[model samples]
Target: MDLRSRIEASYKRIAQEAYDKGYADSIKDIMDLRFGGMPDESLAALREIKDVAVMRSIQNAALSWDRDEVLTLIAQSRSA
Candidate 1:
C-alpha cells in the first residue's frame, strides 16, 4: 500500500489496541506532550478508535527523534 493508506490502516489498528489496553488517556497525554496542550484536530483524532497499527506507525515516526530532543521540543513548545 501507499504511505497514506498504510497510515490510515495503522491508525485503525492502533486505535483498537489503545481501547483494549485502556490507554486512551495515554494517547491524550502523548498528544498534550507533543502539541503543547492539544489542538482540536488532535483531540478529535484521538477520539476516534485506537488501533495498534496506527499507534505503531506513530511510534515509528517518532523513532528518529532523540529522546532528549523530543523532550526539549516539548518543553520549549510548552513555554512558548
Candidate 2:
C-alpha cells in the first residue's frame, strides 16, 4: 500500500483500540459497582470481542443488566 494508505490504516487501528479499551473499561466499572468485581471468564470473553460496535452495545447493556445477564450476552457474542 502507499504511505498515505498505511498511515490511514494505522490511525484507524489505533482509534479502534482506544474505543475498545474505553468500552471494556466502562463495562468493568459497571460490573464492579453492581457486583463488586467481574469474573475472569467474563473479562476474557470481553477481550475476545474485536468489534467496536459490539463492545459499545455491551457497555450500554451493562449499565442496566445484572452480571449474569451481561456475562451470558458476552459469551453468546463470542460464540457467534
Winning candidate number (TM-score): 2
Candidate 1 minimal-lDDT segment of 10 residues: 69-78
lDDT of 1 by residue, 1-80 (tens): 99999999999988866574554355456545665554454445544534556544444433553344434443433344
Model 2 — which ten-residue stretch has the worst lDDT?
Answer: 60-69
Tens-digit lDDT string for candidate 2 (1-80)? 99999999999999988878778888888888877888888888897788877877777677776566788779888899
TM-score of 2: 0.83
Please give the distance, in angstroms, between residue 40's alpha carbon in candidate 1 and its true position after superposition: 1.6
Among these predicted structures, which one has the highest lDDT?
2
Which residue segments of model 1 deviate by more than 4 Å? 1-21, 59-80
Whole-model Cα lDDT per candidate? Answer: 0.51, 0.82
